[model samples]
Target chain A: MEFEYPIEGGDFTRAGMASSQVKKVLKQLNIAPAIIKRIAVAMYEAEVNVVAHAFKGTMLVNIMPDKVFIKFIDEGPGIHDIDLAMQEGFSTATESVRQMGFGAGMGLPNIKKNVDELQISSVVNKGTTVELTTYIS
Target chain B: MKLTEVVNKLELEVICGEDLLENTVTGGYCSDLLSDVMGNAQEGQVWLTIQVHNNIIAVASLKELSAILLVKGLKPGKETIETAIQQGIPILRTNETAFEIAGRLYNLIRQS
Candidate 1:
């Protein structure tokens, strides 16, 4: 099954809606609790990233028998240095965003830990695309 | 133990999802950082934090958490309560800080 969810940038209030919906679908499919938890965390972090950065983004989820694939595509001001962004304590979040307990620079690291495979590619001033895949088993 | 039991024992105020007070509490996690909670918190656990944004509700729901306990007398945003009600996860409040509440919750769960 495949699903697509739109993410509104700078919309902190509705940040994790996409992840929540995907979680519900996973639950209905009877996905194992451990697997669901990993995917949920990855998806939520990706969703938050888009909302915190990007002009807007789209989350595409492909659920197969053996694995789940997710893609987060967003517009503009892409990462200048992917390595730095992947670090545990590096973030470009504004004061207010950090104050909300988000933008702690743990988003990408957490995603990487939970997902089996992660690919992040970005063009400075252009856009970013993050692809994540996790085995269901 | 039921959520109501925790509420009564800890003197936590039920901010929303009153019907869900019957939900069972399997464990508890105390953290204010969204990523920490998202990365470490488990399902059916009661999350203790002072973060009062709507995303807290979103995280709790996504993680299938049983409930959220806001400490240090922190009040949740309007959207937070709304999301909690929508997600069927109770949003609980208390005057205690995260450390105090977490310790009490640990003892309560252990005793139970």
Candidate 2:
């Protein structure tokens, strides 16, 4: 099954809706709670990134028999250094984002830790795309 | 132990989720960082933090956390309380700091 959800940047109120929706799908499919938890964390972090940084984003979820794949595409000033962003303490978040208890530079690291595979590509002034996969079977 | 018992013992104010006070407490985690709670907090664990934003509710629900305890007398915004109610995530508040509440909670759970 496949699903797509839009994320509006700077909209803290709606930040995690996409992840929450995908979580519901996982539950209805009776996916193991352990697997769901991992995906939920990854997806939530991915969603928060878009909301906190990008202008807007879309989450495309592809759930297969063996694995669940999610692709996040966003319009924003992309990461200047992907490696630095992946570090535990590096962040480009503005003051407001940090005030929300996020922007500690652990978002990408948290996503990486929860998912089996994570791929990130970005253009400095263009946009970013993050793809993650978790084998649920 | 039940969330109600924890609230009564700690004199925590139920900011929302009155009906959810009966939720069973399996464990507890104390963190204000969203990433830490998301990555490390276990299911059914009561999260202790001073974060009063709406995202706290999202994290609590995503982790299947039993409840959220806001220390240092911090209170969530009106929208946050609404979100907590909608998401069925209980929010408790206390005048003590995170350290104080965490220490007390640790002892309370350990004793039981």
Candidate 3:
């Protein structure tokens, strides 16, 4: 099955909606609780990243019998250096975002730690795309 | 430990989910960072933090946390309370700082 969710930037209140929904779906599918938890963490960090940095974004989730694939596409100031951004302590989030206990420079790295596969692509002035895949049986 | 017993011992004011306080408490995790708790907190653990927002509810729920203990008497907005009520996750409050409360909670859990 497939699903898509729109994320609005600077809207902290509505963040995590996609992750929550995906978690619910995974639970209903009787996926292992541990796998569901990992997906929740990865998807939530990605969702919050969109709210913290992007102008707007979309989360696309495709769940198969043996695996789940998710993508986050955000339109905003893209990462100039994907390598640097992958570092645990690198973040360009604003002060306001930091004050809310977010933007601790752990978002991407945290997402990477949880997912079995992570691919990040970005253009300097346009946007970014994060692809995540995890297998569950 | 039943969540109700923790509330009584800690003198936590119930902000919501009063009827659901019978949740089992296995442990506790303290962090103000959302991702940290999301990455590390175990299910049935109570979360201790000063952050208050609707997203806190999301994190607590996603982690299958037992309850949220808001230190410094910091209260979430009305919508947050409503969501917690709906989710059956209790929101408890105290006027102590995180440092003060964590110590007490650690001792409580240890003794249990």
TM-score of each: 0.96, 0.98, 0.97
lDDT of 3 by residue, B4-83 (tens): 98999989999998898899999889998887888889999999998888889888988999999999989889989987
Residues B12-72 of candidate 1 have per-residue lDDT tens digits of 8999988988889999999889999999988789999888888888888888889999888
Candidate 1 residues lying further than 4 Å off, grouped into runs, are: none
Instruction: Give the Å shift of residue A51 in candidate 1.
Output: 0.3
RMSD of 2: 0.9
Deviation of model 3 at A128, angstroms: 0.6
Cα lDDT of model 3 by residue, A1-137, tens digit: 99999999999988887788889999999999989889999999999999998999999999998899999999999999999988987889888787777888888888999999999999977999999999996
Order the candidates by lDDT, highest first.
2, 1, 3
Model 3 residue A42 CA deviation (Å) reads: 0.2
**Reproduced native contacts, each prediction:** 0.98, 0.81, 0.69
The true-versus-predicted C-alpha distance at residue B22 of model 3, in Å, is: 1.2
Score residue A107 of candidate 1 by CA lDDT.
Answer: 98
Instruction: Point out the higher-scoring one by TM-score: 2 or 3.
Output: 2
Highest lDDT among the candidates is held by which one? 2
Best-to-worst ranking by DockQ:
1, 2, 3
Q: Which of candidates 1 and 2 is the stronger one according to TM-score?
A: 2
Model 1 / residue B7 / CA error / Å? 0.8
